[model samples]
Target: MSEVQKYTIADVASRNGRGGAPVWLIYKDSVYDVTSYIPEHPGGDVILEEAGKDCTKAFDDVDHSSDAVTVLKKYKIGEIVEEEKKYDANGKKKKRVVAAAPENSGNRSCMNKITCGLLG
Candidate 1:
């Protein structure tokens, strides 16, 4: 089977502009969102230049583990995206992420199914 293609930071930035998609740059499996951290980037414009582009080399140069760059899932990034949605909101129409219920809330999956079934 063919490997699934992953996106570079540059590709994401170019696709939507500065903040575009809050993408997780997966080098090996662990995910990192360099979006919110862009301005504070130590590499300055070079890092920004690498924005939307793969920063594997940059990451390596900085000593980030290669194995920590995989398992990127868009759904796992509710926090940063929501924080970004708060200030400097962009895009034609904004999509909001629903926060996961707290731990004390019981049977989340069942509750979700029931709620969805009701809604449907």
Candidate 2:
């Protein structure tokens, strides 16, 4: 069997529509290249707003249908690397680890909201 590829948050972040590379986003620890889907996204360019970052919360908030989730599988390129996992105060690993946005991306809180919602 072929081994599944794993990508670190940094690796995924670096590929965000730059140098002609596709944009990758993480959902439930799986990395997906949604570049092709961008133009066709029902929500328009909102998806691109979270490009190269984790979007689990935002995706779940929309309550995608089973068929929609199934469609997402086609874009699955890899899983998040182990080191990117985050832990809570009790040391249990969190289900979603929001990736750091690029330095020039304004408003860190907004990016956090895009990935994990307004817990802060």
Candidate 3:
């Protein structure tokens, strides 16, 4: 099989709404070109705010439906490079930091979670 394309964060950032290049963004380490879909986005121009940057948190915050995620597949472009990904001193991708919940709240969602690796 042919190799999948891999892009650096900088490579994707440079194409944001400039010239005629498509607006690309990263989500969960996967890169997508959403230029054409911008106008069709249900959330409207708000999506543009995340152009050229990692939109993982913003995307998850909205709790988008599975259908919305399926739609994103059509725009799939590539994956981010390893060196371009944020990593801890031990060389793993930085875990997402979430705030701790109140005591006795029965909530322990603040623990660190491993994100997709570079190839993923």
Candidate 4:
């Protein structure tokens, strides 16, 4: 397969429709240059609400028609860099690793056990 073009989120953000810059937004992992479609958008300027950022949830929430989906594919310029993709190859959302809560000192645990026993 041909190597797919890759773009970082920053690259997509840089195209935000400010001044005369192009309007680009990410939907899932693919970046779409919607600048040309802006005027034709059936929803009018509402599309600009998500300029330069991921609009996966918003797009899906709208329950767009199959025609809209097809039109969206036409504007796809490239995929987001693999490291930055929110979904895996199979399109499942990646799990984020959250920092664990801090470990409590032994004193706190011991005090809590004793206090629990007394209250019982």
Clash counts for the predictions, in order: 15, 0, 0, 0
Q: What tens-digit string does per-residue lDDT give for candidate 1 at 15-42? A: 3225455534433222355565545545
- Candidate 1 at residue 22, lDDT? 50
Tell me the spans in candidate 2 whose CA falls farther than 4 Å from its real position: 86-120
| Per-residue accuracy of model 4 over 67-90 as CA lDDT, tens digit each | 999999999989999889998777
Residue pairs with backbone overlap in model 3: none
Which residue pairs collide, candidate 4?
none
Quality of model 3 by C-alpha lDDT: 0.81
Provide TM-scores for the models. 0.31, 0.67, 0.68, 0.77
Which sequence of candidate numbers ranks them by TM-score, best first? 4, 3, 2, 1
Over 1-120, each residue of candidate 2 has an lDDT whose tens digit, in order, gives 888899999988976877787889988778999999988878888887788888888888999999889888999998887777554445444777579866765556666777776454
After aligning candidate 1 to the native by TM-score, how far in Å is the CA of 88 from where it should be?
36
Model 3, 1-120: lDDT tens digits are 877799998888887776776789888778899999999999887877888988888988999999999999899898888666665545345877789856765533334222333234
RMSD of each: 17.6, 15.6, 16.2, 3.7
Candidate with best TM-score: 4
Runs in model 3 deviating more than 4 A are 86-120
Cα error, candidate 3, residue 30 (Å): 0.6
Model 4 misplaced regions, further than 4 Å: 98-120
